[model samples]
Target chain A: MTATQPKPRTSRPGLLGIYRSDLGKKYAMAISGVFLLLFVFAHMVGNLHAFEGPEQINHYGEALRELGEPLLPRTMLLWVGLRIPLAIALAVHVHAAYALTLTNLRARSGSYDGRNYLAAGYASRTMRWTGVITLLFLAWHLADFTWGIKTVNPDYVRGDVYGNLIASLERWPVFALYLMAMGALGLHVWHGAWSLFQSLGINNPRFNAYRRIFAIVFATIVTGGFVTVPIAVQLGIIG
Target chain B: MNLTLRVWRQAGADAPGRFETYPAEGIPPEASFLEMLDIVNERLERNGAEPIAFDHDCREGICGSCGVMIDGVPHGPQLGTATCQLHMRRFDEGDTVVVEPWRAAGFPVVRDLMVDRSAFDRIIEAGGYISVSTGSAPDANEIPVPKDAADAAMDAAACIGCGACVAACPNSAAQLFTAAKLVHLNLLPQGQAERDRRTVAMVDTMESFFGSCTNHGECETACPKGISIDTIALMNRDYLKARLSDRRLLGRS
Candidate 1:
């Protein structure tokens, strides 16, 4: 076993095997989560056009539709750039979460009448619940806005982004739903952003402080940015 | 001091265990938790009943033999102390304490309050040691290890393999335990030779019996040795590095 000439590496697990390993599943979750995080931030930023009034927000929406006109064709960039990659990242993230959750459930400790905790954070403890709520919200978001489903969005008007946002959010129930979903998103992202670093092997005592602050700040900004638009519409400021 | 005790009583590994109530009457508060249990066991035997079974040795706490979930917390509510080191004074006179075994898929109940922790031994056997030819012991300071590295390594080495971490973890993840072992060796110069191999082997072996870590930090909280969760960060990093560097070092994937 001395350190000498290396032997053939025949026993090592291959790429596929590694990917299937628990650590590999963690890597998948972390990497996919990074992409989703980027999308949410970019989304909040893009939606900020609402602050400028209807014309500006509508103009911003059109830009997305015609993002790669001529060079890549209309909506091509939107599909390849935003929609496709986001869907893939979301799928991978959910699959990894589901698989890891199944494993955790079976690796059981026999029941105790009382169980106490010391260090697990509130956000971390509720990750699965928050994640599920966020997923369901995503589905509703796609149906109401992107697909412009008539039943889901009774006032949905094609190509009228400002009108649609105002029409949907003017309803108190929908506004409440949006606020609740954003809250869940904040909890999910707060723990998730911090967790991704550990899963990606980016942990160090140096960055540890910034890691927590960054996750908290990011979660707040994203949630605030999103919840503001619906609130503005409901309060008759934007509408 | 008197207390009501609900002990998990199992006749065998596959036996159905239940909480059997016993009264710790007129016992000394200064008794260690295990000693209190011993007093109760003596009472049960004197009453012509079966004595409760639990593991213990070197009750000063260094042996890593004794552990139990007292009232749902691994190693009880006390911070950074094993069950053997936990004094009975920590509880109130009439407190109702529920005692249970360290439960996990990897740790099967052997009998009342005792679990088979050999899964940890298997993980160690996988690749926990550094390889060197047998000879006269080398000089203590031969390698000139950085003071900070040595300190961190010692902190990791303090883990006595008590399995309290797994018992406390919601996911039953062994990352904290695995990481403690990893940091103990991986930070040393002599450990550099097989650092990657050891990391890969040990982590993989752990995964087979345990759940993936979700960064809950419960393991660190329950660790009797006060082993930091940062050791888990080191294990994750080393495992990833092994996957990359081992390919290049061994030549051809």
Candidate 2:
């Protein structure tokens, strides 16, 4: 018997490699999570302009569409170019999250008879449920504000950003749904923001405290900023 | 101490298992957890009942062979202690204790309180070594390693390959075990030649069988050696760099 010489071949992992491994999927989730976090912060700040006045908020909405105008075109450039990266990030984030969840379920053949959580945190345990809630909220948010769907908000007008927002939040049911969604968002952001750093391999004992603080601060600000608009509208403050 | 034990009983790997209650009376306080189990098995044998089977070796903590999930926490709730090191004194008289094997898809039950952990061996086999030609031992002073690096390497090297980290994890993730193996060698200059290749291959192998790490930090607590979770972060960093810059594919071009 004899052994044959093997042919030389490259062992490099290509772009698809990120999706092939759990660690790579985690890195993808972390990077996309950071991108989504920045977008959420920016979006919350823009929405807070409603507290100033209807005209200010309306102008803010228009400005978003008109960004990079002279160099590019209206809304065309914004949707086609500027928002492409965000859309890609969101798609990758959702895909990776779903894949990880499935893998986790398959890994556990059976659960403990009487389970006790010693080191697991509340946010970590509830991430999947909170993530689902946030996804549903995102779809409804796009319908009520961006697409001006009458089913979500009867008063939603194509160009009336401020009026549409106030009208939607004025209703008790819509406000309640928004509140619940914000609660879920708060939990998701809190866990996601703190853990993403570790997922990206930035774990250090010295910065753990700061990481917790950052997660809390970021979640509070984003959730608070968005929730304030609806509550103020209900109180006639925005009107 | 007279305690009630709810032990998981199974016939074989493919067989279904369940908790069977047994009264462990007259157990000594000084007896280790495994010793108490030995007493229970002796009683069962005298009664013509099947004796419970569990894994243990070296009776001391160094072997890493003994493991059981006691009351849902791996290694019986004693911090940084293996089952062999957990004395029966820790449990109160008449307490009800649940004893179970490591529950993970990657670790199928071989019998009562024992599961196949060869998945870990397979992962190590994937890339957990440096390619060195066997020869005479090098001089002690040949390689001058910094004290801190040597210390860190030793710290990561303390992992005993116990599967408690997997059993205790909510997702059954093995990131800590894989990370410990990677960090122990990757920190040493002797492992520099195949650092990138080792990282990529090992990580890929791990992902094939285990769950993803969500940073729950449960694994660290469950580890008998008190292996730090910092090794996980180091592994992640090395893996990312390897994915981007390893010379595996470039050789083709």
TM-score for each model: 0.95, 0.94
For model 1, state the Cα shift of residue B60 in Å. 1.3
Q: Which ten residues in a row have the lowest lDDT in candidate 1 chain A?
A: A1-10
Residue A68 displacement (Å), model 1: 3.4
Candidate 2: Cα lDDT at B180: 96
Name the docking class for model 1.
acceptable
Candidate 1: lDDT of B100?
Answer: 92
Question: In model 2, what is the error at residue A48, expressed in angstroms?
Answer: 1.2
The DockQ of each candidate is 0.42, 0.42
Task: Give fnat (model 2).
Answer: 0.59
Q: Which stretches of candidate 1 lie over 4 Å from their true place?
A: A1-15, B134-138, B247-253
The C-alpha lDDT values of all candidates are: 0.87, 0.87
Cα lDDT of model 2 by residue, B1-253, tens digit: 9999999999998888988999999999999999999999999999999999999999899888999999999998788999999999999999999999999887888899988888788778878887884345765347778998899999999998889999989898889999999999999888888899898878877766778899888899899999988899899999988988957667797
